[model samples]
Target: MSNIIETKVCSEIGDIEGVILHTPGSEVENMTPGNAERALYSDILNLSVAEQEYKQLKQVLNKITKTFEVKDLLTEILEINEVKESLVNNICKSENVKPIKSSLLSLESGELARQLIEGVPLNKTTLTGFLSDERNALRPLHNFFFTRDASMSVYDHVLIGKMANKVRERESMVMEAIFNHSSKIKSKTLNPSSSKHHKDEITIEGGDVLVAREDILVIGTGLRTTTQGIDFIIKKIKKNKGKHSIVVQQLPSKPESFIHLDMVFTLLDRDKCMVYDPIIMQPNKYQTILISIDNGKVKKIEKQSNLVDCLRDLGMPLEPVYCGGKKDIWIQEREQWHSGANFFAVGPGKVIGYARNVYTLEEMNSNGFEIIDAQSVVDGKIQLSDYEKYVIAINGSELARGGGGARCMTMPIRRKKVDW
Candidate 1:
């Protein structure tokens, strides 16, 4: 396939045709204990180890379909003088470092792309800069490896994330610029911040939103995404002339592990979904609401029993697959923390996840998904076409520590429409 691709994702478990990835680079290793918390990480990661693990994912996806790296795409767009100026201006103005705009634009596209992801060293020429404790004038995007959080493709449009944390706002801006300026990709973008309904409380991350079907969306509201953020999506749906259903699942805000919906739930196949038992299956204070829209207006709004049941009622029944098996909640909690439930579907019934989550992999295996090592596929020792249902397991001892799984590390740009 050519590099020119149109962005379209009508379902969560569709066969992926094209995806965007960011291999963990100097940006990830640039963090220290002092700034780990600000970077949304519980602990600092070893770049070498993380890169080794990430290679499995990249190679497997490359074997299956077209894969575009974030750095490559950014570099391609930066080659255009107008786009280079506009993007540099946006980043500098947004970060309140307008003084460096001219310097940034002076660099070549490749070097400029490197500095945007990696940190640009603080120019200590100013007395205040010399006195500051900060290491980088524009902090490195430490969480950029988790490409799913910044922006997402919904149907034919890309919804630019209104990141909950200010530290990650640049990721969204970069993504918006890619979609708007990249000649290789064709799609429109919907930015919540650019809309009239934008507010401080309205924040939406890609990890919190799932496209269940062409007209159905399953979204989670918690710390990273707010009720107001879902409302912003609702407003956008209202403008379209068709019936749409949205399942709003409320997530707990206490544990940082529950920061996004993908941490506890993900679509694995046309008839199946992976879920954490405690929060998604068992009874709890968290509420699930169903909102129905028709002809540009909300037709009905009601509380749902749960996510699975809500989708079942909407004609998309999905059998729930336990993240850590159905036997013990203790094991479930341990595995869920490592993103056991986060599975990225390359095709219907074909998915990828962390190999460290043994119990979760066991549960998936028992449910008919053959456990295949990602390295085996990368080495040409195995072919995915030989299995009807399979999960490619990638080494994740280090990547999981970064608080995401295969699904979180990927952003699908184009998917083959599923034959429902």
Candidate 2:
């Protein structure tokens, strides 16, 4: 029950103590063919299959560290009388269904928790409501189960996202309230909408922000996070007055797979990085921009060949492991779309990723990370702690369809500082 808080995420390769996660709920079924793509999903998922895949991740995590479910945390926070009333009211008002807040408040905790994620059905008692095809008053949180995107824990402070869509805004609001009010955790939070220092133009998502090192951050700017969002991060760095470096990578505009930084770039180990060959490693039109801040001053802003090159200049040269294992470019493109490059570091040398990405895993094996089945780790047949470097490869066929990988499905709250 440590309440330690952090505002800066210094490194990605550290021991994770606790992480926040949301297991898929009934809200996933509420979505239909009508708004699936708009919700950022290609098609409606079979909740059963998705849940099974999520369980593998959940089970594996349970073996290594303390895991807190988002619903449980939300339910606990709602028990506080002041927080309960204020949160429900604020949520209702924000979602444009203020009339229902009173009704929501009277419900018991179990029901309320279900409704929050599964959604409150669009009351169709009136003629206007009956004619309207809208499915929910407070629409189902189709993306809540993918907890990694809404908000992120960077160092001691939580970075509350400015969701690209209004439908997901409540997720950020809820996460912020949790970090601020929860007695279980101690953390300061940075938010675009609530921060006085940040202009209203700023918009950032946890998916686009990656803590590459204690002094380095790799960010993606395209659809989800805008230039304004990057500037907002710079504002935080400016105020901190430390030697901080930010590398901004421009991603593709279409084919949503390239939406977040983790999609194309992620830390595998101290000296290795998983990368999409075309966008990150090979030469293309994309630009890698570097911004350096020293002692509250805009020290340097320059263009580099790529992220690896920029990092090399800064003394952190990472060996780029191609997603498709240096084979044909077509395979690289196909695998990258399914999140081959997204690997989550459970600790300094312990990582997790999809075993389906054979080439990607092969590359990792070539780089000296022993491959181990996630089930072995969970069932205690194999000990992850026994190895200095290993990857808990999990079955991710169904999970990858949700447009994420191990890194995209997690939100780490506490990680030990890396030696680097």
TM match of model 2 to true structure: 0.96
C-alpha TM-scores of all predictions: 0.98, 0.96
| Ten contiguous residues minimizing lDDT sum, candidate 1 | 192-201
Instruction: After the best TM-score superposition of candidate 2, give how far the Cα of residue 88 lies from its true spot, in angstroms.
Output: 1.9
Q: Pick out the ten consecutive residues of candidate 2 with the lowest summed lDDT.
A: 1-10
Q: lDDT scores for all predictions?
A: 0.93, 0.84
Candidate 1 error regions (>4 Å):
none
Residue by residue across 1-420, what tens digits does model 2's lDDT show?
A: 435433335678788887888888787877778888767789777889889888989999998877888888788788888888888887888888998898899987767877887789878998988999887888888888778777887656688898888888888877887888877777888877866754566778878888888778889999889888888888877877579999999999878899898999988778888888888877888899999999878798998999998998989989888897897888888888888988888887689999888888888899888999988887899977689889899988778888888888888888878876
What RMSD does each model have against the real structure?
A: 1.0, 1.7
Scored by lDDT, model 2 comes in at 0.84
